[model samples]
Target chain A: SQLAEENSWALSVHEGESVTVNCSYKTSITALQWYRQKSGKGPAQLILIRSNEREKRNGRLRATLDTSSQSSSLSITATRCEDTAVYFCAGMGYKLTFGTGTSLLVDP
Target chain B: EAAVTQSPRNKVTVTGGNVTLSCRQTNSHNYMYWYRQDTGHGLRLIHYSYGAGNLQIGDVPDGYKATRTTQEDFFLLLELASPSQTSLYFCASSDPRWGGRAEQFFGPGTRLTVL
Candidate 1:
C-alpha cells in the first residue's frame, strides 16, 4: 500500500509564479522527503524534513512537515521552466514509500 | 562523486525467457533497492538488500528475485518473463546511518520489455 500521496496529479503555472504541492501520509514516519524526476531521468532528492522539524528551506525551495496531521508541503518560489518535472513525497520508516507524484509544468 | 550505474539500459525479451538486471553503486552504501515504475502506480519496491548475501522481499516481490553478491553489486532476476513485467526499473542505494535524512541515490534506470 502507498503510505504517502500527493494532493494533485498535475499542476500548471507561469514561470515566475510560486506553487505548492501538498502530501499526506497514513502512517508514522521518521521523516518525509521530496523528490523530483525530470523526463527520462531518475528521481532526485529535493528536501528532507524530519519529524521533529516543522520546516526546512533550500534556496527557493521550502518544505514543511505537520506530524499532527500526517501531512507535508513543498513550496517553490519563483518557479522556472527548468522546474518542470514530476514531484513525489516519500514517507520514511523502515523503507521509503513513495507517492504517486505530481506533474508540474512551468510554462514560460 | 557517488554514483550508481545499470547495464543494458534497454532490453527486450520473450515470454518465459530469463533476464537479469544488473546494478552497481560506487557509493558503498549498505542498502540497495530495486523498484519498478508504471503508468499510474508510481514506483514500487520489488526487492532490497541491506548487505552482501542478504535479500529482503519488498511489497511486490512476486515474480521477481534479487541477489546481492557484493557490497557494490545487486542483481534482479526474472526466470519467466511476462508482458506485465514490462516497465522501467530503477536501482538505488542509501546509508542507514544518516537516520531520517538518508537520501537514496538512484541510477539512470533500465527499460525492459517482455513480449
Candidate 2:
C-alpha cells in the first residue's frame, strides 16, 4: 500500500496556463513536501509545509496541505515549458512516503 | 548554493557484480538518506543515517548496505548486484532545523543499469 498518492497520472497545459495536481495520504504526518523532477534529473524540493501550516508558496509554485483530509495540492501558475516535470507529494512521518507522481507537460 | 552530489552519474554493471555508490553533501545537514526510483513506484527509501557511524533501516533494506563515514559522506554498497537493482539512486540530506521542519536536499542521482 502507498502512503501518499497523487490525483492525476498526467497533465498538459500551454504556456501561461495554470495547472493543479492533487495528492492524498493514508496516515498521520509531521510534514508534507512537494518535489519536482525534470527529465534525467533527481527530485528537487519545491515546498515543505508542516502539519501546522496550511499553505506555502515558492516563486510561481503554490502548495496546500489539509491534514484533516490527508491530502495536498500543488499549483503552478503562468506555466512555461521549463516547468514541465514530474511532481510528487511526500509525507514525512518517522520516514518519508512519496506519491506515484503527476507528470506535467507544458507546451509552448 | 548548498548542494548534494552523487558520483558515477551513470553506471552499467553485470549481474552478481559488486557496486558502490557514493554521495557527498556540502549543506552540512545531519540526516542523510538513500532512495531508489522506479518507473511506477516513485521513490522508496533504502536506508538512512542520522550522523556519523549510525545506520537506520528504511522500508526496503533487504539487499543493500549503507555507511555514513563523516558529516559529508554517505555510501551505498551492493555486494552482489542483481537486475532488480537497476534504477535511479538518489542521496539526500536534511537539516533538522526549525523544529524538524526543514526539507531534504537531493543529489543529482545516479542511473544504474544491471545486465
Taking chain A of model 1 alone, its TM-score versus the true chain A equals: 0.99
* Tens digits of per-residue lDDT for model 1, B74-104: 9999999999999999999998587323788
Q: TM-scores across all candidates?
A: 0.97, 0.95
lDDT of 1 at A5: 93
Task: Flag regions of model 2 displaced more than 4 Å.
Answer: B98-101
lDDT per residue as tens, model 2, A1-108: 588989899999999999999999999999998999999888888998899999999999899999999999999999999999999999888677889899999999
Q: Identify the runs in model 1 with alpha carbons over 4 angstroms from their true place.
A: B99-101
Model 1 scores a C-alpha lDDT of 0.94
DockQ of 2: 0.63
Looking at candidate 1 chain A, the ten consecutive residues that score lowest on lDDT are A91-100
RMSD of each: 1.2, 1.5
Q: Write the per-residue lDDT of candidate 2 for residues B19-96, one digit (tens) a residue.
A: 999999987788999999988899899999888898989878988999999999999999999999999999988885
Backbone clashes in each candidate structure, one number apiece?
0, 0
